[model samples]
Target: MYKAACLVLALFAVALAVPSTYDTEHVWKAGNLSYVVPDNAVLGGFDPYGFNTYVGRVIYANSILPARVVVETGVAYFNTETLSSKLLVYDILVAERNVNYVWVRSFDGFYEKGAVAVGTTNKNERVFCCRAKTDGGVLIGTLLLSQKLCIIKHETLALRKFDKYEVLVAQAKGNGTLY
Candidate 1:
């Protein structure tokens, strides 16, 4: 009887040591970019360095990007939970048009790459979507353009895709964004 009681105590202790899936103070932020999981949403594991991407569903995403750009991708549903609108596959999407490169950070520390096609606009912003894989599935999204500049003057620039394991640490150091 004493051995069983001790085992229960050990199990309880381990449970307490594990991090909670929901944290009110857990906010993913990077360089004028920030994201907060909604109270009704369940947040999965997030990256520790650079743009910490997190997977979850928001009741309503109120412009998480810079310059108040609002986007609604689709419904986010978990195992048995009811579907919620605004499924945020990746928490943050960064595109540097000057270098003609696109970088996306996922909730589980995974990254995706894609090329940016120069858009036909006054600002000359690139109009393209980035796709990244997550534990759940593939996430397709686009980035908001901040400015328009024709530095390269090219229609489309080829972007090098990196494997999730290969660019894990390098992405944190601000490398592998451009080809």
Candidate 2:
């Protein structure tokens, strides 16, 4: 009886030690640019780093009212350039391993599929979604990887198609998103 009780206690402790990926403290990543949704008037703000800049570090999403995300045909994009939409809400449809299927709430209070587009640019680069059905394929949080988080794929988390630019979920350093 003591052994069984001890085992249950041990298992409970281990489970508590596991961190949840749904934690909003972690920011989104695409290539070298950390997606930092600011808590300002801008709906969707860009990183201080230029589109071609690589800061070589993780930038947190430090906003209480970050820009709302819109997913069209599995591709994700921001509704506006500012972060003031009360209708913008996100929910994790499913969580697997260290990854999760992130769903964005719609204007009608419905969640839609969110995804990343790879190689949208003719140069075989760029992670953001621009055109539809280009060489730059759409990636989804619904897609799972069998290997390490490298090489952004049709269902990957990284930003670029290839190279060292990997998409990953970055945890904030204390000063992160409230939600």
Candidate 3:
């Protein structure tokens, strides 16, 4: 009888200790330029280091907001098969508040790069999103786990500054497959 009473109390205690909040649905991914278009994603084709030439864009439902992204993958080692790689860059989407930050990642992310050259970019990085005279600013962020056969770097953007120049960390994704 006493053990039964204790078990009931333990159950009641657990019920009270548990916080009432929904944490399961908040998991999200770091916005990749890949998310820009639903069906128009350009697979792969471009110079590994060419800046604007490898870029892409997506016009969202808002109609007024134009989104742009880019992906690049190649071997800089220019070495033999063992040392070759796939480079990538593109528009990284982030959920933002208002227009100031077209996107800001308010939730937590299980960020995993589909791939990277030197391995994972989980290393913290300084991301600078800038522009000329229009709505412009910079961002401070980091790169995380990159695991995929094809290592690629993708960057997404929607800038007010047309002629401004910015430098970002060059990351790559590649295939470790042997054919």
Candidate 4:
């Protein structure tokens, strides 16, 4: 009986040592859109100097018909030299209503406020919009789709129209490549 109990305890300890996976679910009622990040979607690793790093891809879909509309790939890194963590998001592609567009909001390092929006073939139709803040981390933003535009600011969600004055800013400050 003592040996059996010891074996059970060892197995439990091993299970507890394993890292837990992340699963995210986001919903937008006004746009009838839902974004799901499945468990084990992100793969993590360590650099030669023992810095932590992760890479993942997230797919956004329409709730009603369950069609894929957007895909985003992001990379997160923890630098031991600076003792800081940073996330770099790349390849934000949107496909809706038979129209496809690429959003250019890629940023390397950390940022306080960033916004990216993509529209369909029609000039007045907006497919989606994403806002990122350092306080809340990544994957925390409002997703607008299907002709509906929603804006989430400071945790308050509102349905609003796309601003015509909004512009896309691409700043290349360092010697890094822009994709």
What's each prediction's TM-score? 0.22, 0.23, 0.18, 0.20
Please identify model 2 stretches exceeding 4 Å from their true place: 3-19, 26-70, 74-134, 137-149, 155-161, 166-179
Across 1-179, the per-residue lDDT of candidate 4 in tens digits comes to 99999999999987655432222122111211134333322212233333332222222221111111122323322211112233342222222232212233432221212222232212232223333332233222233344232232222323223322121222232432321
Top TM-score prediction, candidate number: 2
- The residue-by-residue lDDT of candidate 3 on 1-179, one tens digit each, is 99999999999987655332211211112234343332322222233234222122121111111112333221111111022222232232322222111121221222222211111111222112211112132221122122111112223333111222221211222332211
Clashing pairs in 2: 42-81, 42-82, 42-83, 43-81, 43-82, 43-83, 44-81, 44-82, 139-154, 158-167
Worst 10 residues of 3 by lDDT: 74-83
Model 3 C-alpha RMSD vs. true structure (Å) is 18.2
Q: Candidate 1's residue-wise lDDT over 3-94, tens digit each?
A: 99999999998765543122122232221123443332212222212122323322222222111112232223211011112333433223
Model 3 CA deviation exceeding 4 Å by range: 1-68, 71-91, 102-127, 131-179
User: Per-residue CA lDDT of candidate 2, range 1-179, in tens?
Assistant: 99999999999987655431222332333321133433221112122121211111111132111111332221232211211122223321112334332223222111113333221111222222121111233222111122212222222222332212222222223443212
Give one clash count per candidate, in the order shown: 3, 10, 30, 0
The 10-residue segment with the lowest total lDDT in model 2: 50-59
Distance from true location, Cα of 80 in model 3, Å: 23
The Cα local distance difference test for each model comes to 0.27, 0.25, 0.24, 0.28
